[model samples]
Target: MLEKKLHSLSLNQIQIEDMFWKEYMELVRNHVIPYQWEALNDRIKEAEPSYCIQNFRVAAKLEEGSFQGMVFQDSDVYKWLEAVAYSLMWHPDEKLEQTADETIDLIAAAQQPDGYLDTYYIINGLEKRFTNLMDHHELYCLGHMVEAAVAYYKATGKRKFLDVAIAYADCAAEHLGTEEGKIPGYPGHEVAEMALVALYEVTGEERHLNLAKYFIDQRGQEPLFFNEECKKNDNKCFWDDTYMQKQYYQAGKPVREQEKAEGHAVRAVYLYSGMAEVASATEDAELFKVCEKIWDNIVKKQMYVTGAIGATEHGEAFSFDYDLPNDTVYAETCAAIGLIFFARRMFEITKDSKYTDIMERALFNGVISGMSLDGKNFFYVNPLEVNPEACEKDYFKRHVKPVRQKWFGCACCPPNVARLLSSIGGYAFECSEDAIYMNLFVGGQIEAALNGKKNRFHVETQYPWEGTVKIKVENQEDSSFTYAVRIPGWCQNYELTINGVKPEYYVEKGYAILNHVWKNGDEILLKMDMPVTLVEANPRVREDIGKVAVMRGPVVYCLEEIDNQDQLQEIYLEENPVFTETFEKDLLKGVVTLKTQGKRLSEKNWGEETLYRPYRGRTYEKQELTFIPYYAWTNRGIGEMTVWVRI
Candidate 1:
């Protein structure tokens, strides 16, 4: 592992002023969070009943109602609170903060005297608390609560919620472990590990960190904890060969021994993130090696062009190597967000650009695709190719929804998108005492300590839309430090200059670094070559043969039925096609649309009645094709969309 120690800035210390990211942050704060709160309270009449808030009220004895929503429904509220906390870091809202604080109070009221906090098991029965650890989400809810508590504590410096979370963590630590009389059960959903680590970070409790490490180390051991838990759950094992096997939870083997990516995509990534955290915090290089192996396995073999993973719709799990299928893919939005979480932790561990490259790829594409333009609607499953009819009729494609939904009973993605977007500033840059690393080319202002001095700077750019980015140093001391900008993996040729003069620099691991002293008005202008290129899949990926996807900068473009009209199957890109970039301020929230030349099969040459024809020369007509960012396609009334086109 590279020993270049790097650290991520706190969301409280950074503000997003970039046009591209600012719009999204505002949307989450102004639209998604409020709408999600309404949905959680079951106030949105047309949306599916979340009953999330109702369950908490019932558990708190303030309302008389049975537990309604999923076992993990409490997480929805926790995630929203987390988002609200992040939003409060920059834009303070009294009512929103009041609502979140009140919600936390309700959650606190529902807690058992022993610090048990899961409402489902509390409202259902105390006896069922640890009975169904394999499928139930008791620890999962606690994990989200811990994360929210940490965010709230960091954002507001309040210890009320943090104490509640720590109490819950202490309760879990007391009940579960490798010690005798304690159940050796890890979370089936795989987040408590990371959440406990976050708690340890804030509270400096060795128990929390030790508990997180214990869970990771105990997972997938022979005579598995989950298998034993399932056996105790009335001899019911999800690994009965019919349902989701143990591998579906990544508990089939020891984490260090398992090299392949498996199980639910979200759970796998979350667990991997926790492993990375424990590896870094404990300085366990062997555990980190496992993380590296799995990272390579996912990125090199199983990842998609849009940076989405998990190919199979079944269990939303990762398939074999290079088994990525576009039309039947299951790239859940939460999974992409989880990938970002995992990738960010990896970067903290190594400061490698490869990890941040994947992080940006997922952020600009798959992760953002989860939310609609209005931010009120969300897509749980993001498929690269969409066929509206097949989504309606095909049983195998039933999970693939053609349009974004306002809400769902299992509403994970909406709040996930909200939290990620609200706290996006933290992912933009990482700084050390002597240097600052710009992981994402987002236009934002940051005030951070570098080289034992306070520094301030503003990043201005319409990135992923325009390749030219300008970094203006607003305030800095007369001291030396390194300022590294990530050169996206897609950009080949680039130019970097300081104060309109060419600067000498060296590229290291995909970052263009400029180190100097005494900078107050120093301006760095980075011009990256953003030529439209057709990206081809590896030959082993059977589904993408003879197909190419459009990419410019970090954004991947796609063809939509609304743009192409019809016969999407007949459109083909020529050997060498010229593409023109145009920014439509009114289109898809002011995005850069691509226009290219292509050929479509002539309608007069073949009738639509025949399914097949004998081998014969086909005639084609030249046509103009318009491509939009893959993430922006479904917002315009999803009809059909595809990332790969015939070459």
Candidate 2:
């Protein structure tokens, strides 16, 4: 039997002061949140209009305008509000809280008498609501709304937003399910399944839990509900393409029978996340096994070196096994974020460090790459390789942006980044009945009760750049509990000592288990060797067969056109190259850059117009290649960037 499931430390319980994460948290608090608020209200000049706020007003009949933006645009505001809720937990601001409250009030006003919300249906026509469950994202919007409401209520102790969420949930419960007169349909886009689970956790509503389960159980069942609905609706879909097929929605087969991770990348992970959560809550071992199988498939075969997924741009989705492309990849930012969500929940259920490893990988590399250092511009597609000319000229690589844009018309990735970064404290720590799991090496102060005894800890570290973590325990009463510190998968050499002496420790699934009676001022030190590593992909990955990716700790390194000359593809690393680490405080918001001696395939002997130049035994000149953290690329003007270089 599984032990009691672990619970993440609440956002209020952990205060992040990490030199690495604090910058991101502060960026979300100060710049990203404010900028998104303006964008949502359609106030950002020279950018695409959001009209999210105006849609709510129009739905409430407080203003006269048709619904604008994507049908799921409401989620952008909810995601921003969720980020604000997390930010307010650590950085209190009266003005921001007031704005959020006002926004919640507007949301409440837009809700119908039947407790139905969603400006697209409310403003368009209430009669047509739920008519196209396979296309319209009504359920998807409600999911984000509930998530925001839960976060806000936790932050402010305000029930207004929570009440709205409960009411809308009740409305959904009344309409969707297996009972007579119910729609018996799930979201075309996922997240509702997980959001309903969140609502169930907060409200203790069995129906919410059941609704989430029903969505999961009903998905990919025989005589697919999506097909039936499509037939009923005369085959009209919001996104009419090959993506409208059942496989793209991950509804081609029953959830339990599905093996490989497939379909839209975001939807696949979002569904898997919900499955993990519901399985944990209900102790469904079968469902948990399914999650494990898919997780293995994704991390082993499908994922990129930077923890990115969705190998193809066609559906913004996963391609076949071992088909992870480099340039024409559509590794959306939200897909990586969703993978983190799944990884965290899996860790919570199983107390396994592998889950946290992937979670850390995605958090440090793929997720952060979505937002700029200043937190203004955003990238929807986080490609591992980029060439300006190819991105412009090659039709297949059109989605690959050489530079992060100020805003996007779709605009989901920015606010998603905001919420994830703001609430990062929750991801860093987890508490069980008899153990405290330190998942991510983030510098912070955390307070949690283990085995009914309160304990406070101070963690200090400069991770990703340097790996020396010092943890100090403070508690009034001497407590005996296991403190599980993760030994990151990438760290081959590490030393852990308690109070200046190495303790008797046991390794369990990648975590160094230190079971001891804790006391005040008992300090623990962890030193992980941060050596630059050259990583080569599996031979199956043809794109990276003879190439190497530079990495230090969890940060993947990339070569940009600014640091090296253009034609980044011409760069090559010698076998067993040596790298020197340099901390440049002035560059890309104080990052540790790696300098290495490598060879660049010289074009000096070739003509300027030579497109098909034969490699005459590969003439090369030795050059010092500069490698910055992959997340920091594109911050300094658009240039050629590649994570993999030929060796």
Candidate 3:
């Protein structure tokens, strides 16, 4: 049987007052957003110049400088604009709005008369445009532009940006497709497929939907459009094919025929997300099953304990199953954000709590870890283990930085984090005609329509720290609908009650289904037992075979050199150790810290001059080890950090 489709509440319809998330939202609005704007204008010192705004200005002929930065530099601006739109929904600022408006006008002015838009081609030679879709990211930039346009229009009901997106999409539809005289190539980075679907939803244009389907259907086909393009361009390949082949671009085979997740981590998830959206829109069960297979392969075999992906730094791509190494993993911040995007689309299709579970896992751990608490610094690569000396001396571990960076020449993670954090309310809840699903325990007030009646809910909780969630129902009329609350996969024991009385409920797809004719002032309380769990990886994972990771609720914990002296690799958690949890308000802007008595190999036996010792049993010294949330690590001074500890 086909499941009823679910839809997420728009950002404006939901307001978050979450103790944990509100602070992040405020950071993005007040600091991150403004900081990024300055960076875009090349105003921030000690940071790599963005040249994003200047590139757009140059393309518009408002300035005479040549194009600079990455091929997708324009995407940073679009992502920031999208974040601004979401922020304005909850916290409106006239100056910020005016700045966004002026930026949009500049972008509009940069558009070609034929509706084509891309600063790279405008500032560079137009004749060379679309010739290198395999590397140049023109379509990728278009996708982010459409997404930002949709978000801006939805937030403010302004059509200026929407019209710009419509024109560019029309231009794409005209130039690239299966139609006669049109190119048959798709985005090397796969966001356009899903962005076009979003544009279709707003514009009610069949061409947009058809274009999206065309992109998905055309990928990995015979003759490999990318190879043909390369051939046409005199066999000139911009990026080396050593690590990134057709498979690295996910164009080796038809997407449905591809079984496992492969290629650049960000591109793979973006493509999978697009496939999931198209599958849902078309009701293609076969395609959705493919999404299921790839998703399982990711979370089950290739993912980190902190919900991070991309096991290897070679290509920033997935390696074989059970190949999750700690110190050398890539786990790019953008990949985690892309994973959340994929998870949300899947949950909207099936209304399953399993999808939401992974979403929350990535949200609280991997995604937020991309940015520092102050929101001024960012991490492009999130590693489970880091050693400053190794990072400096070891070529293989060079990508694993012990501290966050202020900015990057290829600055994609910061604005991506900003947009996701700003629109997080959309991921918190989804609604259908007769049911409402609370996907995450984000404390907020959501106004959604249920059975043709407006229903308001105030969700209150201290999540990740405490698992008790109290949802107060407010409605003008009595509503008979199913309130599906997600019971996290990590939670084993939980209690659910309605207005102080236990209610009849059943579990399906990891959600506790509460069916009732709800009334105003009624309260639903869910208390999930939060215990500091010791999680062991599958034995097949060689690196983590004898190690265990610490987690409480959805937050993964790690030991930092600041808390537990250096040489984190030498520490071992005692067998059957007892952990004590304390809330430290002054630490990392407040977090729950875990402490346990553990053992460390005694180094006194070996003298500084002794390079080798006789084969004897190692001596151990008992020490108290403290663990902070994985996301909170490195916020203090730089040092060694590891998530998995020897047992």
lDDT of 2 at 612: 86
Specify the poorest-scoring 10-residue window by lDDT in model 1: 235-244
lDDT of candidate 2 over 1-647, digit per residue (tens):
43236887888899999878999999889899999999998888888999899999999999898989999999999999999999988778999999999999999999999899989999889988888877688888988999999999999999999999889888988998778999878888899888988888898989889989998999988788887888887766434466436778888888999888988999899999999988877888998899999999999999999999999987888878889898998999999999999999888877888999999999989999999999989999999999898999999889999999889889999999999999998889988878889999999889998888899999998887889999999888899999999999999999999999999999999999999999999999999999999898999999998899999999999999998998888889989898899988899889999998999887787887888855577688999999999999999898899999999
Write candidate 3's Cα lDDT for 1-647 as tens digits: 23437887887788899889999999999999999999999999899999999999999999899999999999999999999999998778899999999999999999998888999999998888888888889899999999999999988899999999899989888889887999999998889999999998898888998999899989999989998998898656544456557888899889889889988899999999989888887788898899999999999998888888998888889878889999999999999999999999888887788788999999998999999999999999999999899999999999888899999999999999999999888888888899988888889899988888899999999887999999999888788899999999999999999999999999999999999999999999999999999999999999998899999999999999988899988999999999999999898999999999999988987889999978798889999999999998899888999999999
Candidate 2 Cα RMSD after full superposition onto the native fold (Å): 1.5
* Candidate 3: residue 317 lDDT (0-100): 91
Of 2 and 3, the candidate ahead on lDDT is 3
* RMSD (CA, Å), each prediction: 1.5, 1.5, 1.3
Instruction: TM-score for candidate 2, please give it.
Output: 0.98
lDDT scores in order = 0.88, 0.90, 0.91
Worst 10 residues of 3 by lDDT: 235-244
Model 1 misplacement above 4 A? 1-4, 242-244, 605-609
Best by lDDT: 3
Model 1 agreement with the true structure over 358-475: per-residue lDDT tens digits: 9999999999988899887888888888889999999999999989988999999999999999988888888888889999988878888887888888888888888998898877
